[model samples]
Target: MIVIQAKLIFLNQQDKQIVLDLMRRWSSCMKFAYKRLLEGYDRKTLKRDLQGTFDLNSRYVDDAIMKARGVLESSRQLDNNPKKVIFGGRDLFGKLQKRHINGKEYQKLKTKWQERRKGNLYSRGDKSKKGNLNTRIEVKENGTFLRINVGERKYVYARIEAGYKKNKRREELLQEIAESNIPYSVELKLKNGNIYAYFAIEEEYPEIKITKEKGVIGIDINAHPGNISWTEVDEKGNLISYGNIPMPELASGSKDKKEYFRWQYAHEIVKIAKEKGKAIVIEKLDIKEKGKRGDFSGRKSRRIRHSFSYKSLLSKIKTLAKREGIEVIEVNPSYTSIIGMLKYAPQYMITKDVAAAYVIARRGLGLQEKIPDNYIKFLNALTVDELEELREHVKKTVRNKHIKKKHLREINKAMEFLQSLESKPGRVLEPLDGTSFSAYDFWRVLKVAVVTPLSPEKVKRDFSVLKELLIQGKWGGP
Candidate 1:
């Protein structure tokens, strides 16, 4: 969907007052509906009550309920308390309660808070109603104007001045809305003592032109180094090119600035795909809030978690690709990094992140990776006693460090994989005739025997150092 913002020009004071009154009533009904929804009130009963309790019509009441429910559901998704949600903003409310300012500053803040709390009105689209029922935009010979139905045959009109120069997409959408009766939603909002109208219309994406038939470009977003590493792989799963886009500014910037940078980087990525005539492949990541307060995650860990905007960047890339007619493929992220570290990083002579991107690209093309022969040999050479010794050494190492509980649990699982190897060394060391050890077993044992001995800093940054140990069987420092 595309949203167009237009400034509302009131022709007369009467029309402005009517709109203001409607907005105030709409916001009140919205707050009331939110409370009812929290109390387990269903939509049918809540809509009836809202219409009777406020001066809004049935349609407006329904819209109010939808808006309230949207806010409630969003808060719940973020694991926030519904009762503690401030309508305007928690920061402004806190300032007012604390009386942090006086005179003009305080009054200015108070007015802004009131506008945010009580100046929202919305109407859903209706194809039969000419885009919207209560709020409709009409195109006449003179100019474009918005017609608002204010109950009892009363109406208020405002001139719409959408800047076509700044947003070409909005201009095209506006032209479409004027030419055809395409369903479009409108939201009237008051910002900085001025009323603005936001129009949301469905966007028809073009057919995909670039696909994975040629190759795929895989992207890996790294938080510590603050860069996006991407690798282009041919159809035969050979690396054609690789590059990195540094985004150090994303970690510390205004929200708008950060969003602008994300869009810019997304455009860059899509441009590369278009040039190469290949589809983009990215990891399907579902990152939840982590490193909560008092979790023993240090300042650095917290910073990395907070600074990572993988979802935001990936979303922007997908949205832009859709508009540009570029096919985007999402692959499972499981073991991509580990597989890269142990296998591709050493073989390809590339950084771990780039190797991970290569793995993702190959996976997108239906390519399956097998354990390298050297890695298989390295694993098979370990005897049962050596496996037991490595497990004990890893346990002691973890016990000596300040590892998080989750990391400790992961180490314990890796140890279990080691114990399994010790218990049935014959089976695990058997020839790869369909009954040998799986790739997962090798990765887990490697984590315990090989990766666990390295320093935490080295493990996080680079894995190319493991090339010596894997190729020459050189035992590195513990």
Candidate 2:
């Protein structure tokens, strides 16, 4: 989809007033529909009620309901209270409530707030209606004009003042909309007392050039360290390239600036993928806001929630990939980090984040990771009593230190896994086959033996020494 923006110039004051009145009614209907939707009203009933109350046509009412539902859904996704949503600019609303400003400055703020709250109109496209019914653009030799249907036999024409000649893509799309029977949606907003139209048109997506059959570049996004790590792997799951994009400065910028940086980083990543001629494989993550109000959250949690936005960066990357005709594959994010930290990090002598990216790349190629024989030997060497003793030692260490509760739980889970392995016959346990002993089991045992006993700060930063411990079957640290 591509959006073309144009300024609308009205011929007379009467026509402008008519457009403003229509926008006011549309905003009212939208607010009503949103309130009713929150109160559990169905679409059919809301549509009927909106038309009756606002005296709008069926199409206008439907669009209003659609807009309202979109806003409600966005709020729900962000885990915000729908009742507390302020339709107008919330900052302006707060400023007015404080009553700090006076005279023209205060009046200007109030006017801007009112315009934002009530000066909007939306009309969906219909190919049957020659692109749009309520608001349609008509091309003429004189210039391009937007014909708005206000009521029964009522019409208003506004001239489009955009430089279509300067933009080849916009000019082509406009010509197509005028000549062909293509559908395009339009949204009009009153900004600073001028009408602006945003035209949304569907465009054909380019054919995918880079495909995963040859290779894939897997990405791992980290918020704590504020960096993105990626590993390129061939079809056989061998690493071809690896790198990291660090954006520590992104933590201290305005929202718009942060978004701009994200776009820049996304462009850089897609450029690399194009150069490598590989599809992009990213973890399908549903990252949520981490810090809670009035909770004793640490600096990492605060940084993750406030500074870095995983979804925003991921969205930018995916959007750029689509536009560039790059194939994108999403894999389950479960255990990618853990698998990387335990197996690939030490074995490949790489950072945990890069190891995770390597694991992601291999997983994207449908390859299964096998537990190292030394890790299995280390687990098999421990008896039930010895495993219980290790668990107790971890518990005591936790008491003396500040180990997270989740780590403690992981240690307990590993102890159970070891006890279950003891129940099997010596023959079945001798090889510790992949089918019987999974990667998850190995991860748990590593947590109990290596990760738990090591300093938390050291484990988070470096994993080079882990290779020696796992190879020598070292059960615990000094």
Candidate 3:
């Protein structure tokens, strides 16, 4: 389903005020629906009760109930606390919108709205004097055009115009509306003192069948701008092309500007996927949890998180892909960034963020887990606890010895090397820098007697070889 919005052109203020009055009346009806819901009334009972209170058309009252129910359902989904379930308010009903009506019923409703305006109850100044006794306005829809009952034949019965003129896009939109089989809903939004109508149109589309192609494109979504990354991989999970693409810097832009950029990035990503004949792969990220964490709990962090617009970007990509007959895949995000940073990043000589994308894409392609050679060997040679103990011992020894800053750097490097080995599957190494002490010295420092002593140099050299092997595996592809 898609919504097309157009500005309503008004030749006079009277027509505009008619729409405004209708909006106010609609809001009142929605609140009544909310009240019934809060009172624990069932849909049928609520509809029955609302019909007496709101003397508007049955369709208008029914639409308000539907919208109120939506508000309640959304609140329920957001929180379990009853106190948090917000009721229908002025903002929600400020724009008139209703969903799912039959064509014949809609036509009848339109005729009723126009005809009812002629009655004494809605007769101009009589409505002002009679107040609640006066008949209220109702919303109507016919395909892309929204019809408003303005009481006269030529006063305010014009169709809402979608004001898209650049490159004649408006014509195309009209054509699309004409071809649509089901126009789901119509909405009236008051923006900048103008009434804008939005039509949610749905057309029958062929089901998407995704066939494995040359490769998949992995997208890594991050909090910052210019850090969003994408990687193209062949069917066997070998990297074809990888790089970081700058997302719109939403942090420092106007709301409209930010929206434009967000769509721009989504469209560009989709275009690239289509051009390469690859399915788009992305991490299924939920930023709400992240935003609640200590690091991201600050106001700035919240803004940054909101700016990423992961959901919006995904929606746009999927919508465009559906039209283009491309497949989009979502993968579990667990440890993808870590794997990309520790192993794939170095091998592919790309940023860790991009490598994360590589991992995501490979996962979508159903590639086997890539393991570092050192991790496989370490998996057998030492337990996770033992590796952790060694890391601690190195850290304490360096602190106690008051080792020179330069030599201490080497110790930290060794710890980092150890950490890389542990990050692989079947091993969990606490991130630490190792001491310059070789395996022989390492054993001596801990006062352990062993039948064989391994040199620190030999161990470090071996680690280097394993790293190289892992990189080679990547180059060889699946």
Instruction: Give the 10-residue window scoring lowest on summed lDDT in candidate 2.
Output: 427-436
Model 3 TM-score is 0.46
Task: Point to the candidate with the largest TM-score.
Answer: 2
Candidate 1 residue-wise lDDT, 165-237, digit = tens: 5653453346446444668888999998789999998956789988998899998877767888899999888
Which numbered prediction scores highest in lDDT against the true structure? 2
Please list the residue runs of candidate 1 whose C-alpha ends up more than 4 Å from where it truly belongs after superposition.
1-194, 288-305, 383-400, 404-411, 429-438, 456-460, 468-478
Residues 158-242 of candidate 3 have per-residue lDDT tens digits of 4446554352344334433432222345556554455665555455555665444777888887765455688888899888887
Score each candidate by Cα lDDT. Answer: 0.77, 0.79, 0.54
TM-score of each: 0.56, 0.57, 0.46
In candidate 3, the residue pairs with backbone N, CA or C atoms under 3 Å apart (3 or more residues apart, or in different chains) clash, namely 226-246, 414-434, 415-433, 415-434, 438-456, 439-456
Candidate 2's C-alpha runs over 4 A off are 1-196, 287-307, 395-404, 427-439, 456-458, 469-478
Off by over 4 Å in 3: 1-198, 287-307, 378-478
